[model samples]
Target: MTPRTPLAAAHAAPLDLGGRTALVTGAAGGIGRACALRLAAAGAKVRAVDRDREGLEALAGQTDGVEPYVLDLTDLDAAEAAAAGADVLVNNAGIQLVRPIEEFPPDVFHTVLTVMLEAPFRLIRGALPHMYEQGWGRIVNVSSVHGLRASAYKSAYVAAKHGLEGLSKTAALEGAPHGVTSNCVNPAYVRTPLVEKQIADQAATHGIPEERVVSEVLLRDSALKRLIEPAEVAEAVAYLCTAQASFMTGTSLSLDGGWTAH
Candidate 1:
């Protein structure tokens, strides 16, 4: 007999976010955009934060409950303050550069750490007081496969992601008693504009032609050949906020096509 999967079984309760507010960083596009739309569809009033104002406007036009908050995450105090009064917080903003550690620009490296790691910390800090007061909150960190495994030519990204993993776990432990759950959703090579840009950067960094980057470099470790969809990653993020997932905190849910299983 085939075992019943999550999709195979009928859901006893549908996701309902009425009276909830969700804050999604990087909500201008990719998985973050999908998450913002999904949560809005579930009746959450979504505060969609992004550095790109144009992208945010376009995204806001397509969704009913998503509103844009335009700010660069490098402003740590602003980032933290922006997260106050949120019931669900999806920390999904990040940037990447493909270069050897010696060749990596110091400024770029610092920016990556600030955006990916420190900003999330500050945002969580800003969010916790309200969550602890209310006795409920969700923190979903959009980590990457890079967080769990190292790759050559991406020193800043790998370092920042690894640090994020530690922070997510620490937050989980501290927030547990207060009904705040912190977890990471780690996906590999999702189809997004960021990845489209990385294809060229990886090609140049790995010294391979652009045409062969997907096959030779990006999917080399992945058991699945194709890239994950943004919506699929959003579904994972959505699941984490459901009542069924209340006990599932401090763990990483990997969408890496079995890359970690190896």
Candidate 2:
């Protein structure tokens, strides 16, 4: 069995999220859903936002302290409204399109950048004042390993994620004096519906078998040779939102199975 990191032990303390309002974007799927459930389990009043109404409702049904909202991150105004009064904001909405820069469509590139980078910036900007006034806040942005390292056929994703890291760092510095913390959880290829779809898309794009896509393409970059779990990502988010982590901000906690170790 693999050993847990010291940070994991530090994050194991119990927290009462009761009475605290948290807004999670893309909460209908994968890592976002996991984070929402974890927050609700810790007694947070979770507002789960997603573009899929049915999925959001389904997730809300399974957990207490959770409310569903169907809103697209592309709608900056709607996102701002949904984020009002939230003590903790998890910017988790993202999309992937695997293609070379030469073949990438201009519109698709813009959309990906908008969702991953622009939306989070706007959401943070909207939430900052409320947090500042309250004198307490937490912002957890779900970035990716792609943010730290580059890969072929993912130019736009790479660019947006890299930008997100820089933004998070800046936000953390500004929020430090206000008792607000901003950080990011950067995970490698996680075993989620989105990743499964990416595997298939990659297979089709490269004329390779699906199995090869997992082993050769995804795992090829990781020293640990395994896909990161969604729960692990959620656990990290939970840690960042705790009181003990108040002094910890503007950092990236990598859940990449040692993807960047080399």
Candidate 3:
């Protein structure tokens, strides 16, 4: 009789993804870029999608397994098609408009929901067939603390994230029977280009200086006073894709520095 390899030995360390394919939206920068690099390091071939051509070029240059796919996720058909054949999906693309609902433009709000909420639905629709056939898949939605809690002057952003949280939970319930898992990593104020822009916009809207925006507004509810690094959020995302996390579906991993504790 042939001896079987130990399960622990096969699982190993650093969470291997040798032949898997990972699709990451908004991969040109911030949490998306960090997730792409981290997954690539775990041996997955990463499809790095974003609208920024130059940023995609730079991202492709930094890694061997990353294939940059420049795309505006508002093109829903194209976004769905881009997700085909992925063993893992990270829905991280998002947009922000900082204005009170009464003052918010209907067009911008529509665009935000289109990109953040609708696109993920289509991508999942496209990816599910393959995942179900293979009987294995991972979906990680890079949601925000705003998904679980509301914030002022971010009506569209907050609404979109809240919708995503619901979508993620629904996916988890349906995908469980097919050996797939869906979850959200909810982080607060990661040090990303998106957050940098938000700081400036918040400052302008609140009549506060940019420096004060971080401590006075953003970190006002948190037990920790610093902005989370993109890598830290990416690590949480990577963990969701690991074998150890196979049972962790339909849940939100809060990396909010204890903001929700309030």
lDDT of each: 0.94, 0.91, 0.95
Cα shift from native, residue 163, model 1 (Å): 0.7
Highest lDDT: give the candidate number.
3
Tens-place lDDT digits, model 2, residues 62-147 = 98888999888889888777788889999998899899889998899999999999999988988898999999999999999998
Q: Please rank every candidate by lDDT, starting with the best.
A: 3, 1, 2
Better of 1 and 3 by lDDT: 3
User: How many backbone clashes are present in model 3?
Assistant: 0
Instruction: Give one digit per residue, the lDDT tens place, for model 1 in 140-247.
Output: 999999999999999999999999999999999999999999999999999999999999999888788987999989998899999999999999999999878888
Evaluate model 1: give its TM-score.
Answer: 0.95
The residue ranges of model 3 lying beyond 4 angstroms of the native Cα positions read 1-12
Stronger candidate by TM-score (1 vs 3): 3
Residue 253, candidate 3: alpha-carbon lDDT = 99
Clashing residue pairs in all predictions, respectively, total 0, 0, 0
- Cα RMSD, each candidate: 4.3, 5.2, 3.3
Tell me the spans in candidate 1 whose CA falls farther than 4 Å from its real position: 1-12
Question: How big is the positional error of residue 69 in model 2, measured in Å on the Cα after superposition?
Answer: 0.8
Error of 1 at 225 (Å): 0.2
